[model samples]
Target: MAEFLGYENFLVAADGAVRTVRPEHLRVLPGLGEHDGEPGSCDGLTLEGVVVDVAFRGVDRVVTVDADDATGTTVRLTADVRDSALTASPGDRILLRADAAHVVALAG
Candidate 1:
């Protein structure tokens, strides 16, 4: 996961760096959603990627994301199938954002 987020800015601590990002801090945005390269101060943590695949977990949808930043790392996240206006799929460009508070760093 750190490999996939090599391009992203993360908070560092004396113990270690953040490896996993909590889902609560992450927000999945539609491709058509408006935004700049990075999430603004008001906005949450954001990541851009392509949908490598999608799976159904009962009523939820698990999305496999390949970071568009070109790190070659793929992340799997879940969301309610009935999110906002749009949903994600394979080959679709998508965005994921998380608040700094919700994103955490762990010592391994």
Candidate 2:
């Protein structure tokens, strides 16, 4: 993941320019594991959602999650079935995880 994070300390100049405070480093991960966060890194993204449906894709199943934070805010994402216990059905709780997700800044 470090390989993906090119900048060490991202900063913006008064003129609206981005810069890094340090040098660059390269790293890699073999695979993304379940439960635990990213390998050798603590960064992970988890969101709560309700399983809307699941479709079988060969040996694995693609689960569709519908997330609503009330206030009319909603988001959706797809995930692979974690285990046999997770079945394709509506109203199931979904813990959408992005073990490889990284934080990025957006102009407000």
Every candidate's lDDT:
0.55, 0.45
Q: What are the clashing pairs of model 1?
A: 18-105, 25-98, 45-97, 45-98, 46-97
List model 1 lDDT by residue over 1-108, tens digit each. 654654333433334444455433455676746755544525334567777777776655656665522243444554334453456778888877666565555655
Each candidate's root-mean-square deviation in Å? 7.0, 11.6
Cα deviation of 42 in candidate 2 (Å)?
Answer: 5.2
lDDT of 2 by residue, 5-98 (tens): 6433233323343322221111211122443544533453344567677777777666666654323356454555536655447676645544
Instruction: Return the lDDT, model 2, position 22.
Output: 24
Q: Give the number of the best model, judged by lDDT.
A: 1
Q: How close is candidate 1 to the true structure, as a TM-score?
A: 0.58
